[model samples]
Target: MPRSLAGFTGAGYDKGRPLLVQALWLTVSTVILGRWWCPNSVRVAMLRAFGAQIGPGVLVRHGVRIHWPWKLSIGADSWVGEDVWILNLEPVNIGANTCISQGVLLCTGSHDRRSPTFEFDNAPITVGSSVWIAARATVLRGVTIGDDATVGATALVTRDVLPGAVVLAPPSADMTSPTN
Candidate 1:
């Protein structure tokens, strides 16, 4: 069957909150957390107010976009860097001392290719303690990074990373000048 986006309906997907609450979240997020100078305390407080389970000392930087704070749980002392987008249609659990570096995208939603209407295929993302996901990395749905694992910059992680494993981005063309 041919793919038909028009037939697509976001069925079986729970937004986890009412429309009013979502709107309010957007307003607050845009007003405060969106500002570059907004302190991490205020950000944590705001997230907590919205039912997020954010542990103490967790630093959520400015420009970090969380689709649903209620579905987010960050352990103690975790650092979410600037411009990190957590598109958590499902729950995202981040353990203690984890560092989600700048410009990273933790995406929990994807489309089912087999479905003609392209139904949603969502899953949670889990990051274990002491994990380091470097800048510009993309963690797709259903991924789990074990403790002490380091995801290199710009890497696309689509599978589970074992404990203490280091996932690096593939090398591109060499930067050295041609030999004379």
Candidate 2:
């Protein structure tokens, strides 16, 4: 499948259109697939049936939650790390040869709590080529990391990053220092 929706969000190119790239078409095949991870060909096909646009040489390891299959794109030879939550509620682009490390949360949508209706918001995420998003990094919506950038582990990215840059999200100030 090209995309799926899970964590409080939704993503895609419009609806009911032929995908430009064929990604996971080779991973598996099925009719009306369901929530799955690291499955065989038929299992992968199930995602395709759900409108996911997977690429060649991509390895989606076990237990990765891909939300919004239709709005997601993984370039060739990209490895989506294990247990990664891809919030494709908006568009998420992963360049070729990139490694999205384990437990990374790519969140592209959120609710507007301040608004009276509490409606959902959308934003697209862009990852450049040859980049390595370290484990447990949260790539929030509307972020664009240029080519060759490195996102450190456990980083919470809320802004755009320049190409070839090494970024580290500072720890939240909420944490209090331990004292004797």
Candidate 3:
């Protein structure tokens, strides 16, 4: 089978929002929130105005890029650090008191490798309460970081992390035990 871009289609992909609204949000988010050095409160307010279910005391730092605000929900007192990109093609649910460190990428979209036309696939990402995703970590599609779990710096998470598990870099060793 020959691969072709012409055969590619996003028939299964739907943002569940109007085009005008999405465009407005994209413009505002890119030009204003993505570039400016605004305060966290202002950012939160802007996100809420665009239909994001942001809770109280959520701190969003500079250079944070949220792809779709309408599909995002952040719980109370969560801290999203600078340059954190939430590429939420699907819904992204963040629980209370979580810390998403700088340069983290929470992506909810991927391309199917088996498809000849490189079909798009999307899934939701869930980060439970008290979870900590360290700096520069990349959480891939359909991942669930459970409550109290700690994902170490630069770790690439491809699967569901168990509750209270500590995932180190390379993600090979299960650091759940005290002595490994």
Model 2 stretches astray by more than 4 angstroms: 1-44, 171-180
lDDT of each: 0.96, 0.72, 0.92
Q: On a 0 to 1 TM-score scale, where does candidate 2 land against the true structure?
A: 0.72
Q: Kindly report which residue stretches of model 3 are placed more than 4 angstroms away from their true locations once superposed.
A: 171-180
lDDT of 2 by residue, 19-41 (tens): 43333432322222333543545
lDDT of 3 by residue, 1-180 (tens): 777778899769998689999999989888888765777778999999998999999999889999999999999999999999999999999999999999999999998877889899789999999999999999999999999999999999999999999998964565655674
lDDT of 1: 0.96
- Any runs in candidate 1 off by more than 4 Å, and if so which? 175-180
TM-score of each: 0.96, 0.72, 0.92
What TM-score does prediction 1 earn?
Answer: 0.96
- Can you list the residue pairs that collide in candidate 1? none
**Poorest 10 consecutive residues of model 2 by lDDT?**
26-35
Model 1, residue 166: distance off in Å is: 0.3
Which candidate order results from sorting by TM-score in descending order?
A: 1, 3, 2
In lDDT terms, how accurate is model 3? 0.92
Question: For model 2, what is the C-alpha lDDT against the true structure?
Answer: 0.72
Pairs with steric clashes in candidate 3: none
